[model samples]
Target: MPDLVPPMLPATGELADATDPARWAVEFGWEGHRCVAYVRRGRVRLLSSTARSVTGSFPELAVLAEQAPPGGLVLDGTVVALDEAGRPSRGPLLRRTATLTPDAALRAEVPIGYVVTDLLWCDGRRVLELPYRRRRAELEKLALAGPAILVPPSFGLDEAELVVRTAEQYGLDGLHLKRLDVPYQPGRRTRNWLRVPLRRRRQVLLAGWVPAPGRPDRIAAVLLALPGPEGPRYVGRVGIGAADADARTILAAPSGPPPSAVPDGVAEHARWLAPGLAAAVEHRGRTAAGRLALPSWRGLVPDDERDDDLLDMPAAGGSQGGGPVSPDPVRDTGTRARDEARSRPRADAGAEARSRADAEPRSRAGADVHSRADAGARSRTGTDARSGAGPAGTDAAPVPAAGPEQPGTWHGPLSRRLEQHFVYNTLNTIASLVRTDPPRARELLLGFADLSRAADRAEEPTIRLDEELAAVRAYLQIEGTRFGARLSAEIDDPAAAGVDPGAAVPPLSVLAAVRRGVQEEIEPVPGGGAVHVRLVTDPGGPSCRIEIRPADAVRDPFVLFSVPLDVPEGL
Candidate 1:
């Protein structure tokens, strides 16, 4: 096994408008901690994005090391804590990760699952140079069956939209699209992958805070504003979704003078500051007044971000005002409450005037005049009652009609369903193998264990090409045992080819190619068939390539069947 390195990071990008289904594969972008696992000879090490050791945080993942293959392997994945319904709960995961010493009770309460996405090394071979499809194939050959670790299922481009829609429905974050032919590039941003989020995120200015009543040092809500034509316009105030630490940080920042004028309908008591801090906010949409509706603070943004960046934001619409236009005091109960407190004296005077007018009544007029007055009073009262207004003499405003309901997004149960299906099928296959050849079944079982162990390694980035080939051969042997003589395979690498069996290749690259051929081409035939795999070195290049030729020269079976294309020709 080779020395481990930092995990490759995915670049953030928008999904392309149109993409070829054949060229891309999609996986759910989980809402949890990004983790890189190194498994060496049965020891597992979990590292966070910052390369900090998080091994103690998730003890369940240690099983990876015990189940690893003979050689070491490195895995890039996510650590997610699932809720009661089995949906990834980011809050729980965050809490779990923050604990320095996890107790048994905490572990039981928040059981973590590692969702392996990419394979960087296996056995002793470095796989970063292999195409993504090939790496996926290699990963599959590991046959990851997890109580704690499992490979996430991938979808085709045609299923991309459905996958994302399902993710949202299931409370997952979004979908990640990775190009099939691109190789892994560690710590570098590339177009090989794109992330499409379920929610839109914006960076806005954090201009001030409304202090918590008694805890003058604490913030009840932080005032968020965005750059406007004139200057910074108040978007809204965010109290929810921000943690206590965030409040403390905001308070610690140096305070400056308030804005020239407070936005209309905003709390006059809001303590303002210099307009330099920025915050990342998530919301459903903007109110009619261009204020954020149900705005949640994601976190503070870089201090260097400029207000001009927000000028192009779509004019959000709702009653919540973003600027001087006051939100309807009648409809906006929150604003009305705050304003009513400040103008209580004026409200009382207005009530007294109304009472005096009512007291003067019909008796002061003649019969005809009194009748007209009675009719006018009845009309006013009736209209007020219908409009949801309070006592005529008070300053109460009319209630607004309910807004249209937004349709619920679909939460696809695809992830769990597919996982169940895979497990069931694998168990059934194992059962058949046991009935046919118990000794061979034992070997395959050990192979399965080895694959699992390899995936669990905490160290060792690259495995020996020979060891990787061995694992693939073990898998092929298992399949051969199941199908008997009907299935055959040939490894054509010879000393004359000048290819080093000891040369490093991505784990499972060879095996994945062979397995893909068997599954798509050979197994589908009326009778099983043979597959030929040849390993060759580039004459003047530093790369090794594997050439796979199935018995039948059919159109690439993967392309025909629309399965994830996993060939190693371009390696």
Candidate 2:
């Protein structure tokens, strides 16, 4: 067997506005860690894109070795951790990746599957020079299917839009387009193979670290910057757990020059680091100022591995584009509880936010459902609570316009960054329901569509309390579907049933807290969990209170301020 080598990489590219069906083929871009599998003599070895061995991280994939035909074989694909709904999820996969040799308990908790998309070598013959279509043909002939291995079909260019829709429905990363006639070039990011992401993700250079508020000795978040013609351009910071090994790494690195023109209110106590540190960060989109909104740290990687070519890549048709008004995640804004959550494992807001606000943005169509216009212009057409359009009179509440300083105003997007896995899991859950309970599936599907619009809406910093509640309800509905009998949710919003549902509240205010409850309180419980939401209207102002029941000694009921003064900061 030959020594392992870096796998071929796809260059960032836009889907061709016009394409010949015979020349292009598309595959769903699985949102998991990429790997190359080499199977020989009933043994399998996995290598990451950096050519680092990671076989121990995914013992479940060893089934490939047993299924391999006579002679060794080399395959390239992604190693995905499927959630309960059997959707490819990055969080579980990251957990596995963080620990190269996870214990059996962890392994059972996060079983993974190998999604083989390319065949590099088979029957002891190298196929790197073969055209992609031929290589795929050879790969399919192997009939690679197992408990943990799969070979998904590719679509013709004519089906690209359909494929994109399917990927969006299932919360996939995006689509990978390959030139049917081109040969696989090892370790090259070429235009012949294009990567179109459904959401924004990039390798951000770590500029430095910042101390958690009131804790000078502890590292909280890492400042982010991007290489530019002038110099390193300051983007924003992404919060990290103080105890994370990554935090220690940032603290130990020597100081480098500060990024050009660090934004005010930031960089006050930032400790700059020399260049070379980088992280895989994902966000809903860029703010009006080009700063990342809801940036979530995926993991740390060597700066040299940063894909400079992928920077500035334009979104393809049907892709989710970033909005202009979302707040930057680097700001210090939220409650101390949220800050502490940011310091835990999977510390980003996505997980803390029930992965609803944390999950990937919906399709362009879902985003367009709600225009950025004020509450009045954002009404839904249907009255049915379960309808995809969402509850009737979605914008029926007449809200007094308030400035950002108003106590009741809720500004900014969700508290956490959007992740890809939750979206996939939600879709998988909905898909499974289509057969077992079609009506329930339909309701959840519509509810998800409603939540997607809320998640992707490019709105003013403040949204109507009703809209926020609607998004929260949609998320609960989806979670209910995922957990089924294990979870139950109830919303007592008498204020919404009456008038004034349009009271302006910060975006993702209640949702973020609910997400925290579901993630920390509900999801972890063995017998399942319950979420109870109550809306109380008093003279002070209308307050939204969410309670995640079956709490432990450590966790209390989640409570939202009657009127949140500001959006939670630092996703």
Candidate 3:
């Protein structure tokens, strides 16, 4: 069969609050392995996301060859096996994908159907650059359908929200939003298409398992983690539900070293497993220690599946709590040329900065240089490098050099930080609100988008005081959503405190302080607590002070960070 490449992957993000139906196409997101079917002379070959041959896994999909147009065509879609009620079944789907060449009996038992979504190659021509609307129209003209083959209908843009609800009601993953005007982008995770997941689920690596309380052979909970630089970094464990028999059996066979460095108590009873075992885990929130909070088993992840989604480890040369931590909806997009050009210089600078940081001693001086290097790299790339989380927009203008009027773009001792746990927990919080309080969920989702936009400017050392306050507000609002009445936060206007609203302060300084306070004061307390952040001009120097403290406490605030009021000459 002719070679067929994997299709474009959608960037994860929420639907834009102000999306125009005319400009977008909405489709129910499928929960299955991405497959691209290549038909040639009535023969068929199916390729997975990693370009591995999966034709034998679903023999029924070969009917697509008979349904194809005169010339062979390449179709992109997901292969899903359905349950009794017709919802996509993750357990059976995993079994089908892992078996590779399932016999006729196995194929019949877990019959998989191909959900054709996009057309890539048609009439011996690659249609990669056609606008989504035109490409979709071309796909529909082929009339590709059969007993095991499907051409799922794309919902109109006006039905985006309705589609999301329907998907949720039917236990589907979520909705995929595609820009009608954009060309099909293959391999690249662009913002032209966006994925909004109604459920808060993650694929986690299975490091080991804890025996059931009374029955030693039975699993109480399975240890979970993501692949780390040295080994699997433990996230948290999930209680094995009745449906997790497959996961239990895999965990029963221990192999390799312990998944991660476990605590003494956990290490005593924890059984280790070989790498490659992973599971779909659903959780509510995260613990203070960054572990998955109350995770439950979903299904086993096939070994052949790529771990791109499971590789949540922090990127090299980044802060412990700093990286691209926003959920899929926060991605930004730009031209391929611009991205490559911008990335090359930043990569070089980042390498040099890392080298300098490594050579320097663990002192404020070293950190100062490191921060400056990071700031320099970010300033150079500017907002053009930002990934699109909403409708694609024009590239943002580069930040002007620091001057008397412009805020200085120089990171100081305080660097921007966004914890990965926060992203996951915030998503879980949004997921929990979807069914019972969708309005609240949408509000929080918009708030999260705002916060993500703010965090995306991590390279900006300073921003308008009002912007910083707004970010702090969004941060607190999402936290409140997650914590409800247990956690309260307030951001008093700097203007009320006699500070200039237009003045610039280090980006994320106030947010980071509030985050720290929430972690230390509210999260640790059983009853939770309140955090208050307000800015005031320093009495001692020409700088603004951000005081983060407990709202009801009498003790002095733990940490006080200052933002310089005056830009240095010739900076």
* Candidate 1, residue 518: lDDT: 61
Using lDDT, give the best candidate's number: 2
| Model 3 lDDT tens row, 370-438 | 343643311111211112111113232221122222222322211212242355356545544554676
Model-by-model lDDT, in order?
A: 0.54, 0.59, 0.57
What are the per-residue Cα lDDT tens digits for candidate 1 across 180-295? 88888887766678776655355676678987779887788899876543467777888834465556556665556554346755557787766556667766444446567677
Local lDDT at 100 for model 3: 69
Poorest stretch of ten by lDDT in candidate 2: 317-326
For candidate 1, the TM-score is 0.40
2 or 3, greater by lDDT: 2
N/CA/C clash count, model 3: 10
Which residue pairs collide in model 2, if any? 334-569, 349-416, 358-419, 410-505, 410-506, 411-506
lDDT for model 3: 0.57
